[model samples]
Target chain A: MQDSEDYLRKKAFFDSLLTIYGRKPVLEALQDESIPAYKLHLAQSNRDDSVVRAIRDAADKRNIEINLCDRKALSRISRNAKQDQGVALDLALPHYGTADSFLNSLPASFELLALDGITNPQNLGMIIRSACAGGIDGILLPQKGCAQVDPLVIKSSVGTVFKTRILRCKTLHDTLARFREAGTEVIGLSSHAKRTLSDIGGSGCRIFVLGNETHGVSDAVSRISDSSVRIPMQNQVESLNVAVTAALIAFRKQL
Target chain B: MQDSEDYLRKKAFFDSLLTIYGRKPVLEALQDESIPAYKLHLAQSNRDDSVVRAIRDAADKRNIEINLCDRKALSRISRNAKQDQGVALDLALPHYGTADSFLNSLPASFELLALDGITNPQNLGMIIRSACAGGIDGILLPQKGCAQVDPLVIKSSVGTVFKTRILRCKTLHDTLARFREAGTEVIGLSSHAKRTLSDIGGSGCRIFVLGNETHGVSDAVSRISDSSVRIPMQNQVESLNVAVTAALIAFRKQL
Candidate 1:
């Protein structure tokens, strides 16, 4: 119960930080007074174009700080410098942070989903939409081995990425361990599980772990799960798409 | 029972027709003799490249007829002239025809999903994969206002398009009416339905209807549906992805 109380508290901090990349999105974010812009980063080698000049003028008018950085530094921040058009912005999103911080503020009754190595940005975005739409409490996303949340992801999520409760972590294995320690059942979804999702526990404060598209749950995380469940299938279909599987488990009856 | 028996007999005439576009995919289809190739289409203006030569030779060896037509004619055959690369093939795929032909083959214990106005190829492909994986009897794909089963849709379906049963109809509303007359329940899924999916009837040869991504079910189809069902969501989420909704209902147990 305490674990969930902590998440609800952090949920209050929704849309607290959003790092938007690319020229158009950055400029749009800067122009939209509604979205809080902290700093604007520009590649030092950007060509003198009217759009670039316009972006700078907008930042100046808004009193948003503009930093000139090398391509590498900008790439690290934007994650896609080639497409970034030498522009990026750091905005204050409402609720987003480390898994620990999110867990500390979790609600007493919640359903969380831990994404494990989902490499496709479109799939990741769609999964986030499903999780949010299903009313899943929070999503735990590892920093590595997955597609970085970028413009494409934002577009595919249909802009829901901004509002969804997202908890980032360095590694999911460790996060699953932490979830287990909190007396929350860390359930892993796999095609080989003996029990179906209907037979597994979904109620209470629990986390459902979905793995990579090609590979099922990783061995490391699968080893520590309280129980593993499979979505029932009729054909020897190998498995359904990972995002679709997440939807099934996310929307499954809690009881 | 007699309706399904009629379909089983017609299933023997598999792959009577298929129109596949794109250079690589058409070439691949031509090389694979296992797939019946009825005709090979190429633009008269196409350069006589090595790969094109190779394709001609393969088709010659397979006794498949080749048509060298103008760009417009080839595009008409391929449906996607820009991406077709001047090459297309008409092969025979298993189990695809008008809704009347498909319904004649459906089994007594069967589940069908009718897609209405789902224009995205990726979503259509994903839905077909899920339907096949979950053992759906047939999918009603309208001839209008939806993504056609093109190369992208085939790629997204991961080649399940070859084996999955597909029922093509002129309009979804007409298809729903046919299902109704056949004593099959045409259940349209809506986010605003009074009864949840759990509360509705799902057994005994029911066709679960899904509407467009942006718009829910078409008014015509909705009016003809035996009952409307909603997937219960906890979070004030408006709706799930159309493909994911199909997956949930396609795999929902029949009693």
Candidate 2:
């Protein structure tokens, strides 16, 4: 019983940690007083430049733990040797949490933007930005098929990834099924859907599932969707980018 | 006067050619009979693969010329040595033309999507896909300060770049000025605009100008715009992705 409890505590600690790499991003995170940083990592081989100096100064001022390791160790920690620029930072973002916790914290009537099989980091980041800007209650991002919250995603999101409420799950299909069981309407965007997005109104707890860029919503996920709606294309043109579709869904009410 | 006339003739001839590289894209072009082929280029170092054989077969069936050159020559033709994969094709797209020609061909009460300082190739491609799918009459793409119609853009557009009507301009500011002169309603999107996009209806020839990714609409472009509109954003989120914004504008009628 004690071992199981310790394992759960360790898992929770790792789950709460979000590691972001790159010199400029590390410096920016250090400068931001609101960001709760756990540790600052640097490579011993890093050249002493003004940016590096600023990063060190900021981290010292913030009183964050600093670890100076070899290049290989830094790479292992950052997980992106090429673009990490020999620096990485671990931040415990308050807005990031699991789907269960998010569901427990939600109001009676809320909306969420869920992603399935979205592999492009830039697209994932842009979708997060749209969801945040449009005031979607939470973003349901699967830990499996969807893109990870990497540096590219952070860059494309323009730092909104840190600010947005992200609900993580192991698989989108399973989590969507759970939401449906909880009396939430799971809506998928499809080209062949009979009704348009504007047709969807008077929602209770709702989850909008955006699919892959090419193949679209997986068949298993579609089966569980309460209903489907399309954005209504014209001129015989097929579809919009997945990110654009997410934006349309995010700002559907405003429109 | 004769020398100037020759120069103009040559310029028009070169302007009509759209070159796309990479083996798969070239092979796809060869397969599509609707795409007018000008020439096919291949590198001598290329292995005899099934795709290359299919490309040659398709080109031969279509009576297109094939030039097998050195690696250097192939790279020169493709202009992308790293990703060209030893193949290139020149296509005479019917949908591509200059701003002046596009203006001459415009119908009354039409909508055009104009891009200003959109540097991301992926964003430009997604914008083209949205514009084409949403049935926007024309896309006013300033040749300067915008991502070119490169392989990346073509990939992101998912072949809609060939189908969409593209209006190439030397600069967006100059083209918007000309559109204003022609009594067209030039509208710019901004976060600070007093009006929302839905407020502007019953347009007789409208052009919606989207600005740079970081900066909203440029000052010069804003000066020429008859009016400006904003997309309502919530949750203190500053803006949406440029491509997402384009999709919103493109599909606003349906919304």
Candidate 3:
């Protein structure tokens, strides 16, 4: 019973460190100031010793406990030894602007991205990073059928996930309808659409909905879409990767 | 010296099987019409197994000799357990019509795709597949910077690679010049273009040039481009994955 409790405590500690794997992510978490980090893990055999030293120096300044582990142990925890050169800090997810707060903070006219069933965390992170870069007001992700913001995803996003306002919606269809009612044109991307992305000019506030990798936007979501558009292709290729498709449409809409 | 000669002979046998792997890319070297096998390498343990029976039937019909190796020998030759699957065939690159031939066959006005420096085989395959589905005329891959069509590419293309015309150009600049001479409008996609893809509209025979993933188009290519276009983004996301971006433009051209 005592061992189990210790295990649970370790698990909780690890869970709390999800927000602080990458250098940029950790820095962002630290900037929040209110979020407390208890410990930092540094790999002993990192080739680039500068990053490790900087991390150690920062931890020292923060008065956080530092533990040095072997490369194998760090790899085991990160699940990817290739990129993570063995620096992970225990930190909390920051309480940035909430979805509603961000929306309210945005200018009256703005564009947004709504992701439906994009389960690949790398893809999701890329999409979010793209959305943030494109000046998207916020992102709406389905509560389910979505990859949680994991360490790899945070790395992939280059730390944009920390800054982006991500809202988890119970039902994508209902959420899309809400956008539509709020005077936002909810466009769903489909391969069979008669209209191209260019056909829909960027004249009004818009919300672009990107679908899954295999099965596209659900029928329920499609039914409520103001318009469905497709990216053109040649040479008999059926579809593009979902994240790329989203970037194309999102950028096209902004244009 | 004798062993070296034997190795060369075996290699030659596999090389000779390449011709049978074209188009359908299924086993055609086997003698039996019913059994599907181009070439069969068998282990001693399964001398009378179904796999061996199939190979023998095919070999007998095709009048081809079957090479038998001990399990250890076969394992060494195969390098990986990939050989344990009991069948491995040499698959050929899918046949693509010549650009000139495809152009002559097509109507005067049609859309075309020109890839700048797409190095990923999967991306190339997906681009070809999407291009074919979108009804584009032909694909122009720069001889210098594109991925070669191999077995993996054929599989990824899902057989569409067999139908498309993939022209290998000595120089993309020269090719773009040729397209210009043929009244094909050369458009380059970039992040900083003054004109958006939406502004381009449905025009005459259009040739879209997609660049490398990291760097946009080279200055030389950009200078020769008839029009430079950007896909506008709402957020600050820099770019989309090359294949996905290509699909979007291809679909847009179709629309």
Candidate 4:
């Protein structure tokens, strides 16, 4: 039993590690003092160019472990040999946690965003950036049906992917059901809804759910939602971009 | 003098035509009856697939001219041999007009969005989509220092690029100056502004300026602005995404 618990703990730790490749990305990650930096992997064949030198210096300054390995080992570590640029860095995302843990520590009144089947990485990153910058407290990200955190997402977020609190779940429907059971208000966004975004009042633990690009919210997820609100649109517009909708929700309080 | 007038008119007509490539995009354009269809170009080597048949039928229904050309001629027409999928469509943008002409017909107490050096095609497309869907009347598009309308932009706009009223200008600074002279209120969006977006009243013709991705408004443009306002942000985020900012401005009336 003890061995099994140890293995689970190690697995959880490794799961939180995001291995970002490319020389510039690694150097930028090292430069940001707030991002939790782990071990750095460098290909042995990489020449000591200025950027490579800068990455090494930043790593040394942060006291991060530097693993000089062969090209094959570096490729294995990065999993993207063509774009890794002979370097990779594992970052321990301090703000990443599970939904259960996040709910336990939630405040009495909070506004959160839950993404449902957002497949575009750019939209996901922009949503994260807006949620982090605006009045949103946390983001509920599902493991499935959503874009994974990739280099494009990182770029879109302007590196705020490391700064925002992401509560991961196996599936959004199940997690939203649990949140509803726990007395949290789950609101789904739909274009055909009668009520506008301003019609809803902020008074409790609310999770504003944004849906897919082509389709709105999934039927199963919509069934569990407490209410639905639409952003007021003009000019016969059927819908706003998913990321733009997220921004509107994130900054709704300020508005 | 008559020949010169005819030549000028022909040049203007040709300038407004946008030739979009790719099989799916062309078919989608043909299906949307609202879009002004000019001509259709297809490669002779294309097989009679379902999509190609659909495209031909849609063009036939609309009475649009179909130009069947060889592979080399089709490549020259599309300019994207690899991705055009042996099809291209010419669309005459009905809402596209010059800034001077748009200003002459400006409505009283209107809201407008002006792009200043937005380089990313995706960002430009999202901004146009938001501005089109929201309460904004027109978008002042500078001919310089901005991403030109392309297939990626059309994809990002979700076809709204053809619907929105784009007031073209040679440069933003000169046009902004001309608008200021005509008693239009020019508001620049900056993070450090003391006044929030809500602080401004909703009277008179207003043009909100959104700046570049990395930099805020250019110094030359900022100097001529009547005032500036900022979106209220939290969590130490310096600024929102340019497209997000545009959405907020476009939908500010609803808020």
- Return the top candidate by DockQ: 4
Kindly list the per-residue Cα lDDT of model 2 for residues B46-142, writing each as its tens digit: 9998988999999999999999999999888888899899999988888887899877766778899899889999889889998888778889988
Runs with alpha carbons beyond 4 Å of true place in candidate 1: A1-16, A23-80, A85-91, A103-110, A223-227, B1-15, B26-81, B86-90, B103-109
RMSD of each: 6.7, 3.9, 9.8, 3.7
The TM-score ranking, best first, is 4, 2, 1, 3
Instruction: List runs of model 2 lying over 4 Å from the truth.
Output: A1-15, A41-52, A65-87, B1-15, B38-52, B65-88
Docking tier of model 2: it is medium
Error of 1 at A11 (Å): 18
Structure candidate 4, residue pairs in collision: none
| Native interface contacts kept by each candidate, as a fraction | 0.54, 0.80, 0.56, 0.73
Q: What overall lDDT, based on C-alpha atoms, would model 4 receive against the true structure?
A: 0.88
What is each predicted model's overall lDDT from 0 to 1? 0.80, 0.87, 0.66, 0.88
Superposed Cα RMSD, model 4: 3.7
Give the winner by TM-score: 3 or 4. Answer: 4
Listing candidates in order, what is each one's chain A TM-score?
A: 0.82, 0.91, 0.65, 0.89
Better of 1 and 3 by TM-score: 1
Per-residue alpha-carbon lDDT of candidate 3 for residues B1-255, written as tens digits (9 for 90 to 100): 999999988764553232222212333334324333344455565547654566567556665545576767655545444424433343223334345544455466777788888888877877777666656667887768777665456666665766676765667888788678777789998989899877876657888888887787877888899988887654345666565566566666443
Residue-by-residue lDDT tens digits, candidate 1, B65-134: 9999999999898888789999999877766667887668666767788998899999999999888877
Q: What does the lDDT come to for candidate 1?
A: 0.80
Candidate 3 segments whose C-alpha is farther than 4 A from its true place? A1-51, A57-86, A89-113, A129-136, A154-164, A169-211, A217-239, A252-255, B1-95, B100-107, B133-135, B151-163, B253-255
Please state the error at residue B58 of candidate 1 in Å: 8.6
Cα lDDT tens digits, model 4, A25-104, are 88888999999988999999999999999999999999999999999999999999998999999999888777977767
Residue range with the least summed lDDT across 10 consecutive positions in model 4 chain B: B101-110
